[model samples]
Target: MEKVRFGIIGVGNMGRAHAHSLLNDIKGAELAAVCDSSPERLDWAEEHLPDNVQRFLSPEELFKSGTIDAVLIATPHYDHPPLAIEALGYGLHVLIEKPAGVYTKAVQEMNDAAAKSDRKFGIMYNQRTNPLYQKLRELIKSGELGEIRRTNWIITNWYRSQSYYDSGGWRATWGGEGGGVLLNQDPHQLDLWQWTTGMMPKRVRAFCHFGKYRNIEVEDDVTAYVEYENGATGLFITTTGEAPGTNRFEITGDNGKIVIEDGKLTFFRLRTPEPQFNAEYTGGFGSPECWKCEIPVAPGDGDQHKGIMRNFTNAILHDEPLLAPGEEGIHGLTLSNAMYLSAWTDNWVDLPIDSELFHEKLMVQVQNSTFQKTPVSQKALDVSGTH
Candidate 1:
């Protein structure tokens, strides 16, 4: 109980990154076991991992081996929910990777299981650790921005080349990864959008351009319009095709506006609330006066994955609160799903999306997909700088 022994299921790129962090960076956490279905990956683990680290051919085997106290599910999108459920059923603490799962039903089932279990559950929403985002959330929660009126995020800087898409067979395919940029690259932004604003869109209308820039079938470019219950409107735009892309997140409220981009947080505060200014002012075209202020955020990339790992271990050991709860991951997934659904149906999609309809549509794509995937590469790519 002194140090949490962690097993990572999937020795892929993100998986190996977690392994390295657990092995070398994170304190009070030990990389006890590693699992992968690929023989090449297992061989790599054997060669690169410590002599004491246990290796398994499958997650089932890893769960049965009982070599670790907890498991980090870093597998593909479809396998995440079932694997997390299995880990939780085995009475092991679980820390699942982002997006939770491809669709909502399976994730809900996993969430239910975790809720019933006494074990600690966390999600690798590493972006939540970013101090700039954390500061934005604080400002909103603290009412420093007053009532939110509009929000916009254009996070297209997730530029992935053809080789990056070709690197894995299971990537960018409906049967494999489910969705493209929204599911893969922009989950963090989607999560941050709702998390920092503390609001979920009541409805979403989106236009998803499938394979607009990439050769893949899934969507690579997306533009979504969302409306909150509080009548706040928002726009989310992203794509992996654009070079020299933008990564700007802006939120406007009655009293102020916050903009986070280029590793800096900026706020524009109004001298008076918009409503008050509108009610009292006689000027027909003038708006409220404002002062621009650059908000200071703590240095560092928030330690990201390592920070989440440390917190997950601590949460299991000392009953500390988790930075990203496993259940809350569904919110972001729901938004993504809603956007996809909206785009598919050519209409607005409501919140708490029709899980059955979405699943049906997804399976259609899976079954009808004609795009063949290339063989998955065993060579791990260093993704430390990508985030």
Candidate 2:
């Protein structure tokens, strides 16, 4: 086919951004249909979509209408898995928004559905397409950094105000949004954390701050320590209530260190450690001499969401390889689930987690609605710790 027709399932800010880019920017994309259950959202899309495109109130109707080749899901976190499954069942490719879903089991279900369909299945991990992140991945893969020792990220700059959380009712509530910053704000970061390291955590210990950001229920702050199978350690910290925050990540390896902050990715090439007899080296060993340097990277400018959308369409239409496959999405989801579990249990959770057990535990929380209050604690569900 000369062009890939797209059916967008939501018309909110991110959905509209994708539509605008697909219509005007993406080379091989064509706007074919728009679906939104909300009448106002549907009308807004109708007003914005170019001529010759169809508008529908539901995905089923849109899928039957046969106006597009693929479905782009931008719905709420809870609806992504089922919607993607339904779209894939109808022989349509799917590009789901991030977090994949609120739970790891949900992501697995979506993956299973996509596997059965044999069509292109992908998650919107737009951060992977960022030039800097892509470059970092290449560097680690090339062995230029030697053996990785430790990685630390302070991404508190993801500050969210009360008004932002209040913008949607299904945002911070347990019955609605499912989780907190881990669900909504940090999926991309978590995805990138694993992507760059070429590693998945074998165990995790987390401390989460629930109902800490104003009147919201769910965590707005999280501090997690991860141990990879390769023996590398990582520390991840983030919060939505802190202003004047940091988005700095430092990766230390046997040979050097890479630091990314303020959109400028910098490296510190190490020299040698000071002498153990020296005052700087008080027998406890000393630190290495590191020089700030710049790493070479590619140059590109465009929307990552649009880029991934174009990539998904190209992969479906021209046999192109997918950059962010649907299966890899489960890694981030598992990590997110493990963090919550660890925070609740105050114990180190292991990887390759038991999806069914996690699902069962979660179902109990869903049924216990006694904590009818917003932001029900995992502890409240008889889980573990509190922040």
- The sequence of per-residue lDDT tens digits that candidate 1 reaches over residues 246-296 is 999999999989999899999999999999999999978899999999999
Q: Which ten residues in a row have the lowest lDDT in candidate 1?
A: 378-387
Which pairs clash (backbone N, Cα, C closer than 3 Å) in model 1? none
| Native-referenced Cα lDDT, model 1 | 0.88
* Tens digit per residue, CA lDDT, model 2, 1-387: 888889988777778888888889888889898887678877777687877778887778888887888888876676778888888888888898886887888788888887778789998888888888887888779876778889898989878789877766556777666777887788888899989988888999999888876787788999999998778899999998999889898888776888877676787776652222244555565576777888766666334877788788889888889988877888888888888888777788899876776676666655643234332211111111111
- Evaluated against the true structure, the overall lDDT of model 2 is 0.78
* Residue 290 miss distance in model 1 (angstroms): 0.7
Candidate 2 — which residues are off by over 4 angstroms?
A: 271-289, 299-302, 364-387
- For all predicted structures, in order, the TM-scores are 0.95, 0.89
Backbone clash pairs in model 2 (N, Cα, C under 3 Å; residues 3+ apart or in different chains), count: 2
Measured with C-alpha atoms, the lDDT of residue 348 in candidate 1 is 92
Q: Name every residue pair that clashes in candidate 2.
A: 217-375, 344-384
In TM-score terms, candidate 1 sits at 0.95
Q: Ten-residue segment with the worst summed lDDT in candidate 2?
A: 378-387
What's model 2's lDDT at 139? 79
